[model samples]
Target: MPHASATARTNQMRALMGGAFLPSFLGLAATRVWLQVNLFASYTQSDDGLFTVVNNLAYGLVMVIGAAIALRKPFSKGNRTTVAWLGFAVMTFSTVLILAGKETGAVDILAVASVCAGIGGALGGGMWTAAYVRLGLRQSVLYGFLSLALGSLGGLALSFLPEALSYTVSMFMPAIALLCYQRAMKTDVGPQPAPEPIYDKEPRSTMLFIFGGLAVFGLALGISRGFPAGEPVPMDALQRVVHQMGVVVISLFIIWWFIVKRKRLSFSFLWRIEIMLVAAGMLILSVFPGHFTGLAIATVNIADTLMLGVLWITLQDVARHTTTDVYAVYGFAWASRVLSRDAGRVLIMVLGAMGASSYAVTAVIGIVVFALAASMALLLSDGILKLRPLFTEDVAAPARRSAAGAARETRRAEMEGAGASTPAPAAMPSAQAQPDPQEWFRDAFDLSERETEVALLIAQGRSKSYIAEALCLSENTVRTHAKNVYTKLDVHSKQELIDLLQNRE
Candidate 1:
């Protein structure tokens, strides 16, 4: 096992949170945000020999150390989620500290938060993301705000601002956001899958945030595109290639989540190939290299703006469906970022060592080929997807036949028991005789009238939030009870949950 990670740090953070005096999660959060900026500067400043080499070396050392510490925490205490957030926080803090000219103790502070707030932010983000999508955007508005506020404040304070302000932004803001999301998820479900299904509507707050965020990203990307770097054909080709690569990375991160992630989670095709078509169109424009007018570039930019929206919505929805941790998602995002970044660094070092522009072009070609491979993989999977039902049938037939046999066996035992030829042991019901989930919950588990009410709600397909509201309890408490109910009832997945709720036997 890797010895150097954020394990010891996370345990320390968890311990520090005792008796309501929550540890300064913001300070930790600040560290991570700053780390990104520093790591970026380190890898990106290829023009500055001294800065680039030193920064890259720093980047490598920190990541190795952080990972080492991250991997060594206690079972409950050694949580990856917390350590990541805290690590990011530390990264942010250290970056800000160094940038702000107060480099003292930046590494140590980061070492600690790399443990706690990291997990909270990572896990909590996922929980909140799901809550937002399912509960409605308006419902989770406060949660988003709190998170943004936390991030922004920590960012500012750790670098430009000061620690006092950073503490409030990082610790209090995020904690509030998490609590709000937890509350919303709890009361969103009803008592049972009432004969009528409970439907959810998106809140206006989410729409506002989504639009606002896109606008900001657009404005930033536009600014970064750089002014007429010259009409020289070479420069044009370079920009086209780089720009295309950037978008490809975005697709690599976002598109597969919609396509492959959905299928992995037993969801049907969630995104349209039309989306991939746009990428195809861009690739053609890039490879052909006819100088596109600024107007054409502007048009594509707008399309990309829209494309980004599509990506964001896809991500939000995926978060909703999969109940994935937002921070963990971010952490995964972190992994992509770090790997890409480090690869970029290693490549540059090798290129400089060998003296070649050929490596850069080779890298671009490799990216294009990988993108093509990804497309083919999607096509092949879609084909296999079509044959899934046939496979389902192959398994279902034999299972049904066996179920019939068991039913016959049980029927025979019942008749013999009724005749009283002898006092026989109670006949065990066949698998097919299993009751529907709700019925099973009501009878086999002997749940109370109220307990049964809650079980029925869950079985009927009500969400936790709706259940909490109907039961008039906080979401956390509701989850606790739900956990107990699930455990006592001997079920794990929600499908099983529903089957039991309905007494499907």
Candidate 2:
């Protein structure tokens, strides 16, 4: 029995290593490596490096297109696998063509290749994220962040190699991503298919947070990258690499200490810290003028890394909680991120072209952008707070409650068998009392009495907390009941629940 148990654990570990870790490593490594190699290509292709903007824009556009396609596809295993394989071919071919174009100075080929690669990345990334999400939020977030860290290190190493060698190596990443994706899909330990059908609506509050937070993150990263460099700091390439490595290390430590180890910090708290760090880095850069050097760059790098990790983590959390269509949810989120990033890049590129290249001008504009992003983040936080119940509902609390309820019932049975006296039966309630509007809905849908009570409150425009208070039930219980009500009635949102009841006549 012990050997069998150990064997099971070994299989689980292997699945995680192959499934979640490898694909993530390849995907992020490919992205960063592509950017780096393209930059090198740009140096030789054009004196002004304007083609970098085109490359980034191409990637962003394809990501958006792929997300739109994801929305149109039904969430099925077969479709996801097809998308992954197709993405693999496109990305691999594009990587090869772009490198070949760079070597031969074929500008048009590079541009076309960039667009095709972008499309492949979008399709592949969505499918990959879908597989990861099935592993649940914590595993997905952990592996995802680890992948980025490893990828960055790998990209940095590849940056030093000969251009041809670097490009050749990168061409293999999509194939690795495909393998990892397949492994993830074949895992036996992942989340089971949800029994309740997924029918989520884009709540205004949720959308506000997702779009706003991503915009803030993307814009900050874009401006930092595209804003014409100030007087070069007194640092060499090696020093810069070290700084980046250090920042990634520190960021990983912070995430581990707060989230994985201690597990005391809430998502809201961690998010606020991320914003503050980023804003602080920007402020330092602005105040110091050309003096913002190695430390400043490191600070910004750390903040950016944190923001990316947090954004993806939150996105996966949102997908996990809201629907079973993980691919669609993550794809939409990825599209928003890409669009926002490109928007910021375009703005900065235009400003640079228009002679706003001075350090002072860049700093001032950056500060303003950062301030606006901060405000949007605040609004997102408030929105999420107001909708906490909905956000927490889909994290599989129902299964936990079911197990707990069974335990409680078992304890009661044991007590009764041990001669514990039951309370005297209460007098029968009068049947002549006014009929509950709740009863009509309950009978129509075969709802439990508790569910019927929650449904009536929902129909009457009562919040989850209010229903909990009135019924003297815990909030988790209230949410569970409400979820059952929705599943049984085949409704998505509160409005739908009300509509079904009201239109019955």
Candidate 3:
């Protein structure tokens, strides 16, 4: 049994690392490397700040528009695949145009390339979100960390390549990502099928809170990126590489903390860490100005990377637990992030245009940073940012109620067995005469062995925590099985399940 469990786990990990993993890592690396090489890195040297700003604006707007379309009318799987491919093609072409424009000093050509890149990036983001929403929470977090690490490495590698070569290599990355995404969708590593979307009891409030928090983080990151004098200071090659390596180190530490130490790392914890890192970076940048600029930038970059991982995992969690259209949820979340980021950048630009003094600019940035931190604290205080656990303790009340009902049934049976004179109620039949509902439901639903065990316990009025303890499984794993059972049995709630098992009219 141990060997089999180990083998299954190994297989699951392999599946996650292979097909399910590549798209995110490759897509992120490719986008970052491309933008850094062609836009940001060359901005000061080539004096193309306008191009950089235009690209970001276009990217943010197109992403929101694409998300809106997706929310309104999600594409079929085939259509989505096709759109992803189209995006890859556009990105490739845009890369070529960027290369040509750089060689010829054609601002118009670069502008066109920027717009194309935005459209391509938006499409690719939607596709990746769809793929990520399918993974379990642990799987999402693990992959999110590892991919961010690997993606940072990939970007670092590409940053070293000659400009043309880098562009040439990056052009193929989106296509490869699309192919990997297709593979992930086709592959099934577990006995159960992909989980179905469940009805969200409070999607509106939940989404609003999640999106609002992310927007604050995004704006903070954007403002930090645009520090000093509105225009972003691009890191040189060595600084850029070192910054990415720092991200890799952070990712490794998180992986160790979560997996090796077996700690429960929550989203709220990550949120706090991000806020602290951003605050520290903003402080350094504001105080020192010219000195330690690289350090301040690196600090913010690391924070952004961590926040990105958190964002991916949080979005996936929301999608799994909510009945909101997965595409719509992803679309809205990403849109809010991108738009807020642009808004932050524009705010910085406005300050720069107003000819604000260094002190005034620093004061404004500090104010924004404080607001961001305070807003997040408010969210945490209000319990708005608290994620729903995979298995909630709310089930305990239902289990207790069901246990009392069982006890009453048992007492009634005893009275009948004792030959009591008073007649028992007609509605409450003896459970013994009923077909074993556990086995009946198990067989009818074609449940697996583990699922059968879980179902039996649930039918016996066991709370999720009790079942987890009894079965020696994590509550999250148990929830997965429970969800599978609920989905297969066509039931929505524990009480409904108990009533069905009791053969109640």
Candidate 4:
């Protein structure tokens, strides 16, 4: 009876293991078959229609499997670390599948399916990683990072091949990883901490990330453009030191923004913008990279401006989404960008007969892609509308409340001030007539009251010109008073004056 009990337990454990690997194995098979079919005509040029048809059916089936598996996450262990481990496993397993495909036979897959699978897997893994991180599973960070490293390696390595081949080569790594992520993708995966609302006040981290990213980027431009190409752009010793320092400053700023401020570039916005810009950059860069002839250079120039601006805005979004739910969205964006760029190669192959026009067509295509991306950006800005309230109701709440309180106080003070003045006793009281403290100041300063008034005006946040108009003084006269006021106030600059008033100290 004891032996039978042990035997039954062993069989039960064995049965339980089936569901674990079953989905992943199916996913891998689906990816392989689907990819093989999609690329069948384009790469292998095989004449068999039956194989192609069978592969297509297999590809669809794989997605169904993926969808099912993706939905199976049970939300257990409940930490980002667990998520990280699971995500890493999924990623590694997918990569192994990819390796298996390469070893067994990659030529049999459909190109489009391959790209889709690869993209799906990357996203799946990223999604799981974020779930873990957001849940505060720091211990699992190593695993998440490992998945990223391996996934990146696979992406880059696979990129070297023909588009279809690369897609086929790349598809499984994430799928395999997804296998391991079953427990992490649950609805209850993270801490489920509600998003904090934010309002008018800019996030310190966001501003920091933006300025820092821009500064670093700007420094790069300064370095690359500040000097002549062949001449080494003559910043001898001292200048070089300054330039180097500038780069350091920019780099430091970026680090502060990305890490310290924890201001993230949102994933959705980045993807929307990055897809088109990356395509544009590749197109433009393809023309001559560093140098180009008239039309070519002209063609690529749009990309340069767009790339910088896109990077400037999207960095914030990317930083934040990289850790939250649907984290794989970032991977999806990257995969889209990668596919869009690489898929362009297909056009080259199709139009190979046109020779120079082929390249020209590519240039034209780059422009079109850029325009499409711009349009997409416009569309995505609307996406922000949907997310805005969330980002607001959640992230901006405190700041908005604080501002509201301040505004209310200001209104209260103004009401009190108005009530304090009995207009019945004072007709111009609305205009203020207390010794025209304005006039007393004029007499005391050995200057016109208007000048004193201007000094007071400068103290208030009014610009120099506003003060001139208010005092009925010429601009030059106002300037003179400003200088005198500065001297009397023992302030070196207007900024000092403003700072003094603004600071309670």
User: What CA RMSD would you report for each candidate?
Assistant: 18.1, 13.3, 11.2, 21.1
lDDT of 4 by residue, 66-136 (tens): 33443353223444345444434443344444445556677543333344334433333334434343332
lDDT, candidate 2, equals 0.58
Instruction: Name the lDDT value of residue 395 in candidate 1.
Output: 12
Off by over 4 Å in 3: 1-48, 192-199, 378-382, 385-387, 390-505
Report the C-alpha lDDT of model 2 over 1-505, residue by residue, as the tens digit.
9997786566545433322333433354454444444432412211113444555556567666655665676557777778788878887888788777878999888778767766665665666666656654445545666766766676667756776887788787777767766776676544332323332554567666656766667676555544444222343455457545754685577557533442332466656665666566566666785565444544555565556566666666666655446666666666666666556556666676677746657664655466457645554352353434321222223554455456546656755886756532232122113223454566568998788778866764567776775576999999999989999999999878765764564
Winner on TM-score (1 vs 3): 3
Best by lDDT, which number? Answer: 3
* Tens digits of per-residue lDDT for model 1, 372-398: 344334322322222121001001133
Error at 489, model 4, angstroms: 30
lDDT measured at residue 297 in model 3 versus the true structure, 0 to 100: 78
Best to worst by TM-score, what's the order?
Answer: 3, 2, 4, 1
TM-score of each: 0.33, 0.66, 0.71, 0.33
Candidate 2 TM-score, true structure as reference: 0.66
Write down the lDDT of every candidate, Cα atoms only. Answer: 0.37, 0.58, 0.65, 0.37
lDDT of 3 at 250: 80
- List runs of model 1 lying over 4 Å from the truth: 1-74, 77-92, 101-285, 288-363, 378-505
